[model samples]
Target: MSVGKSVRLFLSEGTPGGLITAEIMNWTGHVVAAPRSDLAKLTKRPEASRTGIYLLLGEDPDSVGGMVAYIGEGDDVSRRLYQHSRPEEQGGKDFWERAILLTSKDSNLTKAHARYLESRFIALATEAKRARLVNGTAPGQQPLPESDISDMEYFISQAQIVLPVLGVNIFRTTKPAKKSISPVTEVAAESGTESPIFEIVSKKHGIHAQAREIDGEFTVLEGSMVRKQWISTAAHTYEQLVPKLKQTGVVVDSDDGQTARFTQDYVFASPSAAAAVVHGRTANGRTEWRIPNGGINFGQWQTLGVENEPDTD
Candidate 1:
């Protein structure tokens, strides 16, 4: 009978007396009746036995791809199938629409067999849905492929629908600006000083240097300085100073002249020391000349009250 059909059913005359009635509902809510004789055949089967197996084929009859629910131990297979076929008992109209009942012939339905049938039916439904999506077939199109069906095979053996597409964006990098170090003269002029003793040495090559004084010493602050024709700077600064100096034709000649020795005693004092003795923090030597025994460093001497002797004859 077609799905969703309300039909009176009769059981076997021997066991479990009384006739059973069931209404078969399709996926679309159409109802039909099941035959009483067929119901009787189902009831005659031994209870709780795995003796017989039945397949609920799609309405198309020839359709291979369809759901397959199993009824193993129930007294009335027909009644159980009817339960699955109901709209309210199942999840919804879609569930009953897709459901197909299967029963084992042998009255020995095991838990494992029932589970297997349940899983297979679900998988088949899922695959059918996916296939419809792939073919661009809307809902309620046609019966799914079910030829060469095997009990051992999984229902969703093939791939389903494909995923959608996406998009992305990109960007670029930028560089920082250079800092300006004005000459001491420019700074002194800006401050309105009488005569700025400090001079700015703009060396494009040979130890590109910048210096600030320590306590009472002419310390090589950073990079290298060619003082008295010798490399004299602190060891740490010299390591950094040498490579930068090399870029400008300034070669670090050790006692051996092969390897460079950063044994200079420059920057022995910190900038704070100079700032304490000198008024402002902005002080650089190399330009600020000084006498041998000046009270403060060369950079500090410039701001001192005493006169400074020149290094040049």
Candidate 2:
């Protein structure tokens, strides 16, 4: 369902670590990226003078593992950069620490095209929710000929593909991290189950979860239910996490108001973190998770080795 892609990156400073420009194979779209300190130098390039869209990137002050971004389009992107480089008192933006400029190599993009691209990009970035949008108001879409609109949309598709290769991932949507497991292996010897699905359940609290190790991260799949109320002794980190997850729709409440369920796949850095969230208290995920009704804990399975464990029969 997916195809291979080729991306070419040019280091203007001729080293592996500095200002760089990227372009996808057979694509007219171009992207130039650099740290805030190199803004003046980067804007001096000829491509910066063309009509284009740009993104300003920085950390989100309110959240960890998240970023803040401001997207804009300009007739002369270089001039806009110059303006943003001014002092705060002169109306310069203060939140950005890096800049990425998007333009067409063949100089075919028009003012209307850039505006439409800006609006569409903002919508996409908002939908991705990977970054906090700093723009107070989104730029409205601009009118364009239907044929030109199709071309611009194609340009956007290519831009999305190339931006990530350039390390500009503000537009990326979140997905569970992945790891591989052999397809034909048995999961629980007692039940003779061949499926890899593992679980954590608390019948008293009406919690039942399905999880797996994915690319070194412990992932809880969507629709798995978790405890609605955390214990009073829950860790401070979990105290903060539970509400955040609920607010973000990662966990949703049931009509009975007695439980909350995961709405989407979520990956945790460690199994303990996942367990703590699921049970609403501090827990040792290694010992808490088990092959459903199989009596073997994850820690035992892991300690003895997953694929190599002898059949219990």
Candidate 3:
């Protein structure tokens, strides 16, 4: 079951690209975010001086189609931001382009709490594998009172919910993109229900892959087969992703070394990317992917009830 959540966002500069603040209806946590270019202005904000955890986000030049993140704790977030804002040669990270600071409205968060959150977030981000973590290691969690631990856990859950809305998704460990779904005719559906399993098979290429559109992401399930090599005509955007997947261990060669299989369930930005990767070349995902044994392609199944096509049943 899911309940509605209200998030109040205020753009301090009255611009989407400028400094922004967010808060949940009943959450005491306050979030401040800004681009690295606005660091000077952000450091002047009162909340930037509070004890809190911060996340740095930017594209990873080293990894194709993924982002990099660094989680840390500080009594004065502005100070740490300045340190990281320096050049990498000065012992600072230069990869980040944006920063998000988390603090409490009542100033109740302490150094211990921030440290716990830093360690917890790092571990969570590592497990999610959504981004390459800049953290060298996960710090040990300090022991806190049982009640405080419970409170912080709730805080973490709330942060998880709020972060994604801010375009920060390093902690998204699951495939489901949205929490709810509309009812469809093939099978009874409900909120949070998994998408129907779909597959793409090509006996000629020795490829058989299973996938599902969880939430809204098109995810190729683990053990799905991929073509042996990407063709020259493969979509340029996703062509390099094939090798990157193999290098990251997301996909690996099978026992016979004839083709490859996905080591873990992987999400593609779209059905076409999933299809292109599975086929090792350019392909039409809507027509390529189909409901196994049902004979209906993705294009057909997804458009159900949209028109008054004569029933073939």
Candidate 4:
């Protein structure tokens, strides 16, 4: 189990949608997040001058639900930020509308350290695939002393913990059994028994999944099987999702090359997404997944709890 962390976020502008500074208890790293509209005010802060790595975020114009990001490092974070704030014709970045600056409160990060962090952050964001990386080339790593390398790794770990708090999910992966964030483990259960397992089966398409609702996300347990191919009537969402899942290894070919399987626990934004992937077509997950013993589907179970069962037609 991951230990809980205490993160303190101070809103400098005294509003929910303004400049914010965040720090984890007992850690030297600090994160300052601000909107593109407040760049001038943000650049004036003291942390702006520190050596650090930064992230530029914006919505991707090409795809729905897609984000664009760019990662960079500098000896003077403020100067680099100012340069990027200019128009693209003026040699500035134009794809991002928000900036997240990561710096050390103790000013411990050196030029080499910042470069090393930048290289790793880019690689990580690429792996997460949560956003489109606007970088034209990879920022290669820099050599550091062995001791300093270890210290920087710890700093990276702290950043991983704090970034999610700032809504930076570029490093989060869905494969972990329990997410490092504040994941909900418990589900609606009986008075004394554990949360009952639920399933969605489609013998025709060869789908058999075990899942549970946790923190509003439909989490399909590890080892779930998905259709190898979408049916002819599959929706456009299914067409796009399956290929991306295969690319991400959430859907992988069987050893026999006949079907695909989920290698680890995967969480979907909604039940419909999980169902669509499972059935190889559009689905109504609320009515599709059921408790074999109680004969109640997810929709009723979630609203009425374990004591009540849906009336069968």
Candidate 5:
């Protein structure tokens, strides 16, 4: 059973889309989030004056996942945001439409702590492959005492939990995708049972793929053979769909270049998105995916699942 943790959120401006604050009970970390339009409102907050690491996020039309983010740290959280408000040609990022800042409410976060957190966030984001990162290069780890490292690691765990509740998903990933953000989630996989498996087998186009839903997200498992490339360049075919997956190392071309193989388990928002990538053109995933041996399509299985399911309180 999943245990519940209480997270308190406050709408600083009395509106859901405006300035917001998020915090967990017994946690010293404080989160302040706001849209680019609410910069003035965020700057006035006391947390902005403290040392912290932050994320600047925006859309990436070219990204297969359609999100881009920059992770940075600053001694004065407000100062760095101000600098990034300028034009890109003038040494500022113009891509972001929102910002999420993480500072200590107890004023215990130092510049070193922030830098360490920044490095971990960058590494975790890259490893997850859930979004495109704008950072140019990775930074070497900053040396910190053993105790501080342990405490900061705990801080990151709490941040991971709070971030998702606030709608930041860059830190989230499906478990089968190994080498993931370890500090981002602490839940252990339950014993004695496992999720049902789904597969796609086709002899004509020579495809053999396997996927299953995990925690409400559909996950395409690793080592699955998929279409090497989109067969059509028609109007319905999206540009660079499979190429972007390759670019992120989620899937790679086979030695013969005939089919692609997934390097790791990858999550898709829905069965349709997974099917679209597998077959290489716009696809109706519900019909393309199915159960093995008995041969039931995903749509039918989904409908049948509700027949005798247990209820939640």
Candidate 6:
């Protein structure tokens, strides 16, 4: 008869359960566990102190070999094993008909510990079954071979298939990091100019504004567009424009302590006149600008936009 035909049993603490023994017949009518003595040792071992995993190996002289049906652990390893070995329990069934218990003295089964024991059991069981198979014993009756044990172990290793003992988790958890952002500035274009120049405007006073070059046919940055104004090709481009406009006698002042500011005469005298003085764009104004603030960048000023307009005279 197949091992599945064997009756399975579970034993735990029962009333008057210091140690108990009983036996039952398997489907094959095999005289399994009649007054088995192996269980006696478990009853004698101290309770509530031991902890660790125990392996149960079946034994049958009449069969080619036996198999391992269960793995267990407890604070009292001896008592736990004894419960499973009771004749009336799995001990009487063909499944654990000739059971041998392999146990450790530790109570808590750590993940690593459980894994190690499982691997060891499979390795040993496989080897024994292979030897039996080679000896021409009843192949079907042979205990699990080392290879079979390995297969079983592999099967259990799968997260979905393996059911860990209560209170144990196969995976660990971790936390994610937090994200933060720094202040950003915006640039807007004024009327009668080429494209609006975008700059990094500082939040603190005495900071300089950092200028950025407008790209493509369109003069605009990420968040908004510059309209009706000439924007600088780049910060350096302003250097060239300032000197030429200065030669034209345009009076300039420091806009914010950082930028060289050209009065309306330099920027809006005439569209053609402004275009003639500037090479790349009407403004070409980055170099011509300075922040009155001590340390702000033009880029920062642009980000702040007109919202940072000072009080007019």
Against the true structure, whose TM-score is highest?
3
Stretches of candidate 6 exceeding 4 Å from the true structure: 1-35, 47-49, 61-75, 86-112, 130-313
Supply the global lDDT for candidate 2: 0.77
Candidates in descending lDDT order: 5, 3, 4, 2, 6, 1
Q: Judge candidate 6 at residue 138 and give its lDDT.
A: 17
> Tens digits of per-residue lDDT for model 2 on 1-313?
1244578889998975578999866678899998898887888899899999989998874542257898999999999998988888998999898899999999999999999999999998877656778788998888899878867876776776678777676665434212211122312111011224579987888889988764344677789888886876635675666776776677889876878898876766577878888888888998888988776777776666436766899
lDDT: worst 10-residue window of model 4: 185-194
Report the C-alpha lDDT of model 1 over 10-104, residue by residue, as the tens digit.
Answer: 33243333322222111111111122335434434443123222223222211121122221213344455545444654631222222212333
Model 3 deviation from the true structure expressed as Cα RMSD, one decimal place: 6.0
| Model 5 per-residue lDDT tens digits across residues 228-288 | 9887677553436688888878889988668898999888878887887787777778888
Return the TM-score for each candidate structure. Answer: 0.21, 0.72, 0.87, 0.74, 0.84, 0.23
The segments of candidate 4 whose C-alpha lies over 4 angstroms from its true place after superposition are 61-65, 175-199, 208-267, 284-313
Position 282, candidate 6: lDDT: 49
Q: How many pairs of residues in model 4 come into backbone collision?
A: 0
User: lDDT tens string, model 3, 1-313?
Assistant: 5465678889989999988999976678899889988999989999999999999999985563479989999999989999999899997898899999999888999899998889899988877788898888889997899867766766776677778778887886554534322122122122233667899998988999999886566788999998867876534877887888888888898887678999888878888889988988888999999999967988887887797877999
- Whole-model lDDT per candidate: 0.28, 0.77, 0.82, 0.77, 0.83, 0.31
Lowest lDDT block of 10, candidate 3: 180-189
TM-score of 2: 0.72
| 2 or 6, greater by TM-score | 2
Q: Residue 86 deviation, candidate 3, in Å?
A: 1.9
| Per-residue lDDT of 288 in model 3 | 90
Model 5 segments more than 4 A misplaced: 176-194, 232-234, 237-240, 295-297, 300-313
Task: Return the TM-score for candidate 1, rounded to 2 decimals.
Answer: 0.21
lDDT of 6 by residue, 143-249 (tens): 45575444333323221111111111111011111121111111121111123343333334222222232211111122211121234555543235445434433
